[model samples]
Target: MPQNQPTNKIQNPETSVPKTPEMNERDFLNDMLTTEKYMTGSYNVALNEASNQTLYQDLATIFKETQDCQRNLYNLMFKNGWYAVDQAEQPKVQNAYQQFSGYKNQLPYAVQ
Candidate 1:
């Protein structure tokens, strides 16, 4: 005869400890879907609890700014034909200004 057992640990009346990390079904899933960072396992969802939401938001903003900088750099190089390995060392102040101007004018409201 086969034996039946409780797979999860009963932490308390309020919470159940999952048998495995992968078995956790809440918080991690929320993080993946909503770009919301999780405090614990996938299944452990935060119930609008008090936490540092601003810190995560700031991190997201920083990431976006970094992406924007990279895009601007690529566009600048493209417009000026700055294809050389030592492009930055080469004196092309006028080209830089023109490239920056083009990027500035086109970038706002530009869809990905």
Candidate 2:
């Protein structure tokens, strides 16, 4: 062991954005997952704050986008004729979308 040298140092990789468009199924699915995560986060934060109108609107938009992405993804899968017999988890996704829509509908409206 050298006395003057640094030991066991880990370095983080540089963050570079992807330049090319992703056209594959895996890439599309990853994008959908990312959008869903962001939407859920925005919705939770808006609910937490409870008073930010801008955040509330943003959350609503994100919620719509996430739901649309999910639905379209499934539709594409169905279009490709890939049917799975074990699909107990799909209803839950629909339920979540309905619940989020309900929440959006119930938001307080102030006439200014």
Candidate 3:
């Protein structure tokens, strides 16, 4: 009855209903950063156990690239306010250092 009004619009049953997207860009980037972190950890283990120089160099390169990618993603998320970090206090920092420093004496082999 009014102008610019739809008059009994027909619905198309053949057209499939669109599903909502599972993740936003921030979620996707966070996932990539997390996955890169796991890959970097595995690469560190591989590098430590590798006997061949060639394989070590290859893994090292990949590890470096993965770290770089992770940093970039982190920077992007940080800029977009998708990631948050807490500042460390001097006492907490010194305590962590002192605790880990004590572990040096527990090494299986001689430090020297």
Candidate 4:
């Protein structure tokens, strides 16, 4: 292992905005993103517990729309540099792949 590993981050230049007690564009978008996430989770639970086929289908459609909205909001935020993620190290990613690969043999159905 190398003593020093360079950290990688994915981000863009953030749009400038004044910081104040009042909500700004970033704050509003952040709040909407959070709400969308919560709504998606709720819809997922509702879909799982839905008993009627029609209701399940309706909820599924709504869930997909909500998920899409969430993704768009996330993309917007990321583009504005409001959302940043660290790039995974290659060795760690390979280790995770190897660990999960072993579990494939335990699955009931064959993977092909």
Clash number by candidate, in order: 9, 0, 0, 0
The count of residue-pair clashes in candidate 2 stands at 0
Which 10 residues in a row give candidate 4 its minimum summed lDDT? 1-10
lDDT of 2: 0.61
State each model's CA lDDT, in order: 0.45, 0.61, 0.79, 0.92
Model 1: per-residue Cα lDDT over 3-109, one tens digit each: 58433332223233366757353333333423422222221322234267785565556655555554555444434433223334235867888798788779877
Per-residue lDDT tens digits of candidate 2, residues 8-101?
4323332333557856664565467567667667667666776778877876777777767766765554444332233346678899988988
CA lDDT, candidate 3, residue 100: 79
- How much is 47 displaced in model 1, in angstroms? 21
Best by TM-score: 4
Ranked by TM-score from best down, the candidates are: 4, 3, 2, 1
Worst 10 residues of 3 by lDDT: 9-18
TM-score quality measure for candidate 1 = 0.27
Error of 1 at 41 (Å): 24
Off by over 4 Å in 1: 1-52, 83-112
Best of the two (3, 4) by lDDT: 4
